[model samples]
Target chain A: MPGDAWSRWRAFAFFAVLLVAIAVLFAGASALYRVPPAAVVHDVHLRVEGPGWTIEYRADTTPNSTAYAILAEAADRLGFVLDARRYVAPLDSVLVESINGTRNGEDGLWWLYWVDGAYGDVGADRKALHDGSDVLWAFREYPPREASP
Target chain B: MNVRSFSLRPHKRGKVPPWKLALLLIAAGVLGRLVLWEMPNVEPVMAVALIAGMLLGGYYVILVPVAVMVGTDVLTYALGWSGAYSPVQILGLGAFVYSGFVLAAAIGQAYRPRLLFRTRTIAVMARISIPATILFDLWTAFGDWLAISRHPPMNWSLGQVLEMQVPFTLVHLASSLIFVPIFGTLFLYLHTHGWPMAGPSPSGTDDSGPE
Candidate 1:
């Protein structure tokens, strides 16, 4: 009986050590791959397309500019309305609800963005810009959940 | 009577029949997942899985969690909460999440307590919950990485994955810590009292006594 108890305790200790190791690894990864703060002005290509209208522009912004900031700047340069709001988790970030007076889910249409062609999982405000990055915001019918941003 | 033939039946009795217990657990898990679908990461299913494993033992430890996951996922897909993943993606993600829960329940089964809800029992559950939650988070995060890697524009890196996973993992851990002891204690009382069974047998039927 004592031996059994000892073995159980040993097993518990092993798992405990394992969990601690993972926690350490996670922290280390975060620190090591931390997104560097933006340095120097970044040249970003921006495209905004919606039903019956398409706009293209280029903007030079300070380093560390977020996707949302870039979008807002592009909208300003093109004289269009950009509507956005802050959302809570599991989407704890800025959400662009509408752009150029086109509303999200308006007639089965929603605002979706892609950074360099891949769907952005993190919110616009959270996605940091890199120099020469292509940010595309399209107002299109929402895709199936499989591919929807 | 042949000893082998007699051994086929469950000679050791439980407050509830194992099959029925497994069903009830699956029902609870499905309901919890549905009601809490929008909440993301904060769900009672994990605690229920652990509790079921601890009390029910044997195959129920694994089947209960898997059934709950599959059942709830079907409902989530039907209800349009599948998050736009293709059926294949959903199945892939489900595989990872299901494996995590199964591993967690397996850990719970290792408790092998003679009596439920004792101080030592709760302590052991608490100890197991931490590592189990971490394991679950890591497994699902790997699933997330797999899905994200296919995307073209998204900057995919280990650091980004870790940073993105931190908040979700923390919430999951918190949910487990809160739910395990609470549900474990409540269900322990119910099982000891023969809840959903006829009545509490004054002479306990458990073969394993306090270690």
Candidate 2:
């Protein structure tokens, strides 16, 4: 056991590095399940604002890191006009900023991702919805799904 | 053969300067950054984590940029990222890498941290992180300017490069703010839990001398 300490440190270092690398991989992999094109949204509430056309959805799923992307994505299906430049979104309407989804009361904080508002999860990325409901795309500082006793 | 002076290794003593270990850590972090360069959009948080690890591990500063080149170069080949990187690109990457490390090292060396966390006497621990991260932002911005505008001629005009990188710079700053203290806390936590790599460096560190 002369090198016992080295062996232990090696194990610790290897695992520590492995964890970071794996986390990165998972970040990449998780995007695979994104709504075809890819984005984060484990859950969320969607609300569309307009005069006559209103699409509201309480999508009990995760939300992506970029709120504008969600807005754009939702707009794509709902036929709403997206002015990205005004809101600093690209043509894809992707949010340039990284949002901490954890503030939504869940631990879905993507240190790097897209969103205008935060989400409790990224499962909201694929939430299918009905017509005329206001897609609120709500990403608050508290989780929407948690039960308070 | 002479009877005296039986030193065969690099160092004449039994233990190496702890600073060397720290230098190695920072070098490793730089390498990590390089690896992340071609991934379309490298996560700022990951970059922050890598730099923070280097700092907390007490790694050397120069290692950051050097390792970044090697790491990213290897990853590029492995990942088959299209578009060959010219000498200008390489130089640009190196300059940016240096900007990151110089700031991290300056802050680290100045603060020879023994423990993280705030007691009454340990207020400097938290304060140093802010400056360290801000300095990183400033250096990186300058590096971009120098690399594209003057040094090696780049395809991007001075204004173009500045505008293009403005967003990323903000992201970098934000991530740094989030990262520096986080890694500091992690380093402290690991040290408290008996992680061997968590120990102070073997270097003299010379907290008193000029950097």
Candidate 3:
């Protein structure tokens, strides 16, 4: 019945809202940098905390693909092999939040902040960051080191 | 003598119609594409296709993925995901996968796509994976290279471009492995359980349209 069609329409609308909300959330939470005025970024800082010593290093400058593009780029770059079930958004959030959020919560001791050296924060808008800003990445684990010798 | 008079038969009400399954699966395919961004980061279209695969089986896998790609790609460009990897390049990725998906659909049609763990099964999956991944990956990576090289300031070279691919490829592989099975298994299970809205055959084949 045409009247019964409303039910289906409502369902579609409900999901449609959900989809939009998610898009908005990602839009809201992604790491960002401004172009032209700031233009190029040159450095990011990585920090690792564990056991006894805290280590920090500067990473080379790079441009991020924004929040939406992170997932596609991340899995390809970082070799992340988890079951996303084709749902990159949720995982992407988990990833971005992991990279973007504070390195502490209730215990105030478990988290990572910033990203790939560019100062990253979920609270920061892409348009706000300037070039050469330090991105702070924090980890509880000992940071992996590439063997050069 | 009375025993000879009666033969017992079980009561049956109604057999569900095929159109119901078709409409339902089609809707699911559409919905999957619509909600595809919710899925983890694989190519958005692949997410759509995977969900559709989980819904209607591998038959319309390509179409479903393409649908999500169309939507997200539109949104992305509108949001200024432009430059060298502009809309054309993004769509090119879709075009590239079409041939592969068509092949996949045909294979799906021929085989019952049982959740078999035979060597052949793994090989079949890998065969589908290898080409499909490469096909989609090249379009995207090429776009990335173009964007970087064409950026008047730094015209990067082939090695530099390829060198830059280290991280991207890793992520793609991760996303694909993650989604493909979780989805493929879900569809297999639904078909196996004789889901009321599932396992509809169009003629002799197991199109198994969802409901």
Candidate 4:
């Protein structure tokens, strides 16, 4: 016996509609969450502040440059190791685990980044940068509200 | 018994004890989380909670999901497998996560009378899982924003937090859409047919809806 009022056709129709709705939602989210394409950057300043040490570099980067991309470029030029891992959604971006042999969680500090003195809201790879952009990667505990810069 | 024989022959009504059913559901839920730990937000706990409510009803609606979540939470924390949280953050986040699953169970409870071991019923349950998943994700995302994201290196506005949550919620919806119907049918089948290990029902009655 059929369980409820729904016929086989109705159930199929419902599932088809549900799947389409999900696909629409996925597309909308992808569009909304997408970072705008980055333009070629000239004279972008990058800084990495680790425990008792700081490294700074100024470089021109190709179009579509991101904070992480510039950091990787700087690391290659400066000969410092960049340790990171790519996580899928919800993160859907690379996480910097260590830098220059200093791993995150050392001394209760993790790697965080800021662009132009504003803390990065998205992943480093998603933090688009333009010419004259200032990028700072710092190893520190999360700042209290009053202490945030 | 063979798969065909086991599934085809419905067990005598009231043969499966409520405790056994509850225990099995809770175990399935916890194990699902443990096995799928690498896949964030893709676990059967939500489906199991919903089924528990529909099958066992009453207090089992609350007990089953809570046990699964608390059990997994404790195990993960003890093993240091999950994220680090402060005492306050733990309580705050726990409240949201726990309530989310309970709400799923509540939805199942509401549909208890209508739920049946049939294709149409399965479809309905699967459809309901979408909205249930959205609600749970939204609620917990807000909790995350409140407890963690609002502070720190990323001072995201509520809108930003919600926008970021979209992808995670989509993945969660996919997980639920797959699990709810499968688990719902399986549990409803078991409730109808009574498991082999099931002892006499404590209540000597079948409170779960008609087979």
Best-matching candidate per DockQ: 4
Best model per TM-score:
4
User: Residue A114 in model 4: shift from native, Å?
Assistant: 1.5
Which pairs of residues clash in candidate 1, taking residues 3 or more apart in a chain or in different chains? A38-A64, A118-B153, A145-B84, A145-B85, A146-B84, A146-B85
Docking class of 3: incorrect
Taking the tens digit of each residue's C-alpha lDDT, what string does model 3 give over A15-61? 46435544543443232212223333445333444335454444355
What local lDDT does model 4 show for residue B145?
Answer: 91
- Determine which window of 10 residues in candidate 1 chain B has minimal summed lDDT: B1-10
Worst 10 residues of 3 chain A by lDDT: A140-149
Clashing residue pairs found in predicted model 4? B11-B193
Q: Estimate each model's TM-score.
A: 0.66, 0.39, 0.38, 0.79
User: Which wins on DockQ, candidate 1 or candidate 2?
Assistant: 1
**Candidate 1 accuracy as lDDT:** 0.67
Compute the DockQ of candidate 1. Answer: 0.13
Query: What is model 2's interface RMSD?
Result: 20.9
Superposed by TM-score, candidate 3 places the C-alpha of residue B112 at a distance from the truth, in angstroms, of 8.3
Residue-level lDDT of model 3, residues B39-148, one tens digit each, is 43344234334334323433344454454445555665565432223335445544554544333333333332333322223234433443455555565556555643
Off-target runs (Cα >4 Å) in candidate 2 are: A1-149, B1-59, B82-84, B112-127, B149-165, B191-193, B196-211
What C-alpha lDDT, on a 0 to 100 scale, does residue B153 get in candidate 2? 17
Write model 4 residue lDDT over B63-123, tens digit each, in one string.
8999999999999978756553555778988899999998888777665545344666677
